[model samples]
Target chain A: MNEKIRHLREQMKRLNLEGMIVSNPISIRYLTNIQAEGTLLITRKENIFITYAMYMEDVNSTLTINDEVIVVDIKNISKDEFENFFLFCENVGFEEGYVTYAEYKKIYQRYKVNNLVETEGIVEKQRIIKDNIEIENIKKACEITDNCFSHLLTFIKKDMTEKQVANEIERYFKENEADGLAFETVVAFGENSSKPHWIPSDRKINSGEPILIDMGCKYNGYCSDMTRTIFLGCILEEYKPYYDAVLKNEILSLDQIKDGVVVKKATEIIDENLKRNNINLIHALGHGVGMEIHEAPIIHTNVESYFKENMVIAIEPAVYFPSNYGIRIEDTVVVTKNGCIPLTKSDKNYIVI
Target chain B: MNEKIRHLREQMKRLNLEGMIVSNPISIRYLTNIQAEGTLLITRKENIFITYAMYMEDVNSTLTINDEVIVVDIKNISKDEFENFFLFCENVGFEEGYVTYAEYKKIYQRYKVNNLVETEGIVEKQRIIKDNIEIENIKKACEITDNCFSHLLTFIKKDMTEKQVANEIERYFKENEADGLAFETVVAFGENSSKPHWIPSDRKINSGEPILIDMGCKYNGYCSDMTRTIFLGCILEEYKPYYDAVLKNEILSLDQIKDGVVVKKATEIIDENLKRNNINLIHALGHGVGMEIHEAPIIHTNVESYFKENMVIAIEPAVYFPSNYGIRIEDTVVVTKNGCIPLTKSDKNYIVI
Candidate 1:
């Protein structure tokens, strides 16, 4: 069996769960490496994947004998077979976070298990600390992202539309061996940058205005996220202090991220620094990045948790002035024993394009 | 109140629900035109949208006095306030398909309502029939998609990779005033086309091979989906029959799409025709396309439903030969009283580039 599945089984045993149904595609991929539309069943003695006929070939091609996964086509499976998969199991687990209420009812009727319990995010918690191969893929994705940012510095020009700039970044990532974008590229120019989750519009870049580009790409199923706020021609005098404070806080936050560091404490430090500058941290300080751009160990003042080594996360510090402009600097980094190693090595200093 | 919300309230009356929670963002956008992270509550006397502080500005800006949606910051609302949102209501409806089991529990505890009943997809079923504005947006999107296909014919070269072609299509849409892709462009070269949902890879195009491109784009929150399988140089003798049969069935299926036409009958006709050619239809014939690429009134043999007027749908007929190549032709159309009007008008005739 794969190391991930073995680890998952151990966790299942600890939870007293005799069987589990992993329906979230990301979790399925994490366990079996089968990127198909299917439901993964972890019974007492078997790891089975049920999919439609269309995906059977892809699932078969992705799995091997060592994976210990049996692929069954949904068209060929009978209701009795589904009910019998976990026949003698005492308790079955389901992803409460992903499974819809209606689906919960349907699964209850179909599986006919004694008790269907929430898995308590057992797979997701395990995913917080990525394996070695996961780190390598994320590192490669970050390298490509940095290169794309470099290309954008030269490609971006005054009067160019934000959508155009966003498109170019996507094209650059695709041409540079990226699987795809981790999320939609956010290219906010001038006053539009004030919104934390601004969608790229036809707003044109103007001289002496801030341009925030929050972008990421996927490489080998791992994700890399980075955001850089730059100036079109020259930085405005009033914006200089805000940019300096944001950069300072970003660095302070990254410096505090290490093994055994409290997630909330690190975020509090950044929040305090921002507060000193008369700015508030609007969103979470950052979030863990892996197969999904946003995952476990959310760096927020409300999350009571600790950072663990091998966990890759994005740390972003920002200052947003409503209807004016925003300055945010972010980087994807890997948590280390002492500190954290920044994977996205883009220049944070003020740059005039 | 907006027509969409008014229609929803009427449906709520029929379901014997006094209050409802609309958590799906797409449904919320359809009702209030607010494209932000929020939960919409349809109370007896008010339309309330509760969102986080970050989305307050965007949501407020998108909504107006006529939208009648009162935006509230989640931070300002207390637990008691949450419990009062659906107060004095005997039954409150929820989107069972969208809300997860955990969220269902959370809402149940928070709302403090007498009964939480499924809305039975009241909003989604209403969305099946596109309004005038929605149809206009879908038509515009389809126009751009057709133009994109035209551009690809001239731009695609012998050695261009599948990813390159997919990127170019995306760039074309972005440059031409698209809201972005409705879904990821599926570009399969030669043998890769056998898989219906093949992700574009590094596979390069070759002479005398099939190039299947299934692409779409969003315009004004509406979607357009189309697929075309073209020959790079020449259609092989064995593949011509499959292409011709798929094209014939695609047209036959589209011709049968009209107001009040039985959905299952339309799909059954296509299936029977494909069976005569010794080919099996592996997937649904098509799906309704509006705000989402795939929506209600799924064109399948199992669905006991009827096509309604102004319902936008995609009719796709395909033939796949595993380990070889596949041919599929699709188009988005609007069902009318007598027949259907094709939105995507890309030529189905075999083209050798």
Candidate 2:
């Protein structure tokens, strides 16, 4: 069996689960490398992936005999066949965080399992720590992201719309060896930077205005996210303190992120620092980055978890003035035993074009 | 109150639901034009939108006094304040399809409601029929999509990579007034067209090969989806029959689509027609299109429902041969009393680029 599925089975055994139904497509891809829309059944003796007829060809092409995953077409299976897949298992686990209430009820009725219990995101927790392959993919994606930022610094000019800049970033990523964007690229100009999750608009960029770009790209199914707020022509005198404070907190947060450090404590320190500057950290300090842009180990005042080695995360610190402008500095990093190493190594010094 | 929320309240009254928690972002956007990550509570006497601090500005900006949606910051609200939002409510409905099992339990515990029942996609059901504004947005999106296709015909050349073509389509959409892609643009060349949901790759286009481009764009908030299978240089003799059969069924299916027509019968006829040509309809005939690319009134053999007037949907007829090429002709149309008028009026005739 593959390492991921074996690790999952070990966790299932510890939870006393003899069977499990993995429905989330991301989880399925993580476990079996099958990127089809399907439900994966880990029974007592068999590991089966049930997909639609349309995806059968793709699924088979992705699978090898060594993977030991049986691909089943949903159309070829009968109601009895479906129910019998997990008939003998005493306890079957499901992703409580992913499966909807209606789907949970349907699975219970259709599979006829004795006890359907909550797995409580077992697969997601396993994904929090990046394997070597995942880390390499993320590193490559981060490299491409840094290159894109460098290209944008030269390409961005006055009168360019936010949408135009966003499109160019997407085009750059696709043209490079990257597999498109990790998420929708956010390119906010001037006052539009005040919105943390601002969608790119057609607003034209002007001289002496803040340009916030939060973008990422995917490389081999892994994601990398980085945000940078730069100035056009020159930085305004009033925005310097806010920019310095955000950059300082961003670096401080990264410095505190290491294996064995409490996530909540690190986030709290950044929050206290920002508070002293009369600013507030509205969002989480950072989040685990992997196949999905956002994953577990959310760095916040509420989450009381310790950072672990091999955990890839994005550390972002920002101060937003409502209806004005915002300054944010972010980096994707890999947690180490004593400290963290930044993957997105773009210069955070006050940059002007 | 807005017309959408008013209609929702009417539905709530019929269902005997005194309160409802709308957690789905799309549903919230549909009911009240506030595009933020928040929970909208429809209480007995108020429409409240609860969001985090970061999104407060955007949500408030999107809201008007006429919207009557009171924006609440989640940070300012305590545990007791949250529970009291649904106080005195006998039955509070939640979207069973959208809310996960874990979230459903959390909502039940946090709200302290008398009964948390399933709303059974009330908002989605209401969204099936397009309002005048929604139809106009969809039509505008479709117009942009048709323009993008016309541009691709002139721009696509031999030796251009699939990814390059896909990126150009995205750039075209963004350069125009369209709001990015409705979904990821699929640009398949040669045998890559065999897969229905093929992601664009670096594979170069060659002469005398099939090129399938399934793409869409979003204008305002509405989406447009279209698929055309054209020849790169020339059509092979073996592929002509399959292409003709798909196009024939595509027209036949659209001709039968009208207000009061049974959706299942329409799909069944298409399926029978394809089977007569020794081909099987692998996927759904089409689906409703509006704010989301895929919405209600799924045109499939299992769905037993009547096509209602003003319902915007995509009618796609496709046939795929394994390890070979496939042909799919699709269009977005508006169902009227007499027949359906296509919004995406791209030519279905075979064109050799």
Candidate 3:
């Protein structure tokens, strides 16, 4: 049996669930190495993967017979057979955070369980702590992302449109053996950088203005996220202090974070430091990263959570002046007992390219 | 008032809903034309868009004072203020097909309405019929896709990996001013073409083997989908008949589709013809395409829906021999009063690259 599934079963036992339905494709991929369209069912006796005929061939090629997970084709199985898979189960669990109410009603009718309970993101909580293999994959993804950023430093020139720069970053990831982009590359020049989630446009990059490139890549199903605000030719005099304050507070927040530290406290430390410099950390300080770009334990003023060891997180500290320019410095890091070590090893010093 | 929101409000009135919460980003984009992170709330008297401070700038730039939707920064709003937005509403509506159970619970607690009724995809149903602007956007997207296919005929060669071919297709789309790909490009060589959703791999193409390229592009938020199967040198003797039958049925299915025709009847006609040739139509014959690559009014044997005027859909006919090879012909079309007009004008005749 897979260790992750076994751990999930133990959690299920605590909840008194006789069966659990995992429908989220990300969770399905995390549990089973089968990266295909399928739903995983953990009944009282066995683990079955239900997929259509089109995916059976790929699933067979991916999983061996020795694997404990049983593959069942939905096309081959009758409706009665599917319903009977959980006939005796008294308590069933579903991912309420993922499944819609319509799908929930469908599962309730199909399984005919006495009690359909919410898992309350048990699988997501389990995924917060990165295992050795996951850490390795994330490290590889970060390394590739770092390399791509370094290449962009040399490739990005004055008067180039943000879209062209974003396209080149994506092309670099593909050529450098990344699975693909983790999310859309955000390339905002000058005032456009004020919007944290600004989509790259056809605006030309000019000298003496801030250019923010927030990008990441995926490798082996794991994701890496990082952001850096770079100056094209020279940093503006008025923006220099803002960039310095952001960088200083970014390092300060990094120093405050460690295993067992409250997430809110760490974020507040950064928020307060920026406040002293007349800057506001508008967004969350950081977020856990794994197969998904944004995941568990959001580090913000309101979230009351503690840092855990081996959890990979992207720490982004940004200060926006609103319609003028914004500065953000980010890095992906892994939590240790005492502190977190940065997985993204790119230089964070002021770069005037 | 915005026309889309006005239409939604009229539907809400019939459902006895005083307010509606729209969380799906696609639906939000369709209604507000603001492509940012937020939730759209349609109350009894006004439309409000709640987003974070970071996105307020982008949201403001996208929408104007003349727009009916009022942008509210979530940070500035108090918890009581948010809850009061729907305080007086007797009945609230939610997208049961899109919102998760957790989100449903949150809405229930916050709104404090007498009844939280399921909308049953009222917004999506309204989105099915393409307006003049949407049709224009889809047509432009299809034009780019057709041009990309034409360019690939000259670019693809023997010994080229499937990933390379897919990458070149993507590059062509970007260079030709497309926003991005509608979905991941599927490029399969030889036997790999048997799977409908095969991910592009590093498998090298060889002479005399068929290559299947299913790709689409997004232009101005609308999507266009198209698929073409080409031979590198010559079609195999065993695969020739399968290709010819798929092509013939594809055109037949296209001819059968028109405004006011039942979707299933159109699909069944092609299915019966392919059945006579000892071929099975494994997947849905086609699907509506607009803002999304796959949308409403699925054309399959089970769907009991009628084609509507101005509805853009992708008509695809595929025949797959397990572990052997497959051929698929697809095009995006707009339903007319008498017949459907093809938006994708790429040549579907057999091509020997």
lDDT of 1 by residue, B1-353 (tens): 87888889998999999999999989999999998888999999999999988788778899878778899998899989999888899999999999999999999998888999998888999999988999999999999999999999999999999988988898889889798899978999999999888889989999999999999999999999999999998989999888889999888877887888888888888899999998898889999999999898888999988988999999988988877899999999999988789999999999888
Runs in model 3 deviating more than 4 A are A64-67, A76-84, A87-89, A237-240, B16-18, B60-67, B75-90, B236-239
lDDT of 3 by residue, B1-353 (tens): 87888888998899889999998999999998998888999988889999987678779999866668899998888878877888888888888999898888998887667788889998899999989999999999999999998899999987999999998989899889798899999999989999898899999999988899999999999999999999998877887788889889888876888888988888889999999999888888889999999999888999888988999999998888767788999999999887789999999888999
- Estimate the Cα RMSD of every predicted model relative to the unseen true structure: 2.1, 2.5, 2.4
Each prediction's DockQ? 0.88, 0.85, 0.82
Which regions in candidate 2 have their CA more than 4 angstroms from the true location? A64-66, A237-242, A274-279, B64-66, B76-81, B84-88, B237-242, B274-279
**Which pairs clash in model 1?**
none
- Residue-by-residue lDDT tens digits, candidate 2, B1-353: 89899999999999999999999989998888877788999998999998988678778888888888899998898999989988899999999999999999999988999999898889999999999999999999999999999999999999999988998998898889887789988899888898888999989999999999999999988899999999977889999999999999888887888999899887898899899998898889999999999999899999889998999999988888767788889999999998789999899999998
Ranking by TM-score: 1, 3, 2
TM-score of each: 0.95, 0.93, 0.94
Tell me how candidate 2 scores on lDDT: 0.92
Clashing pairs in model 3, backbone N/Cα/C closer than 3 A: none
TM-score of chain B taken alone, every candidate:
0.97, 0.96, 0.97
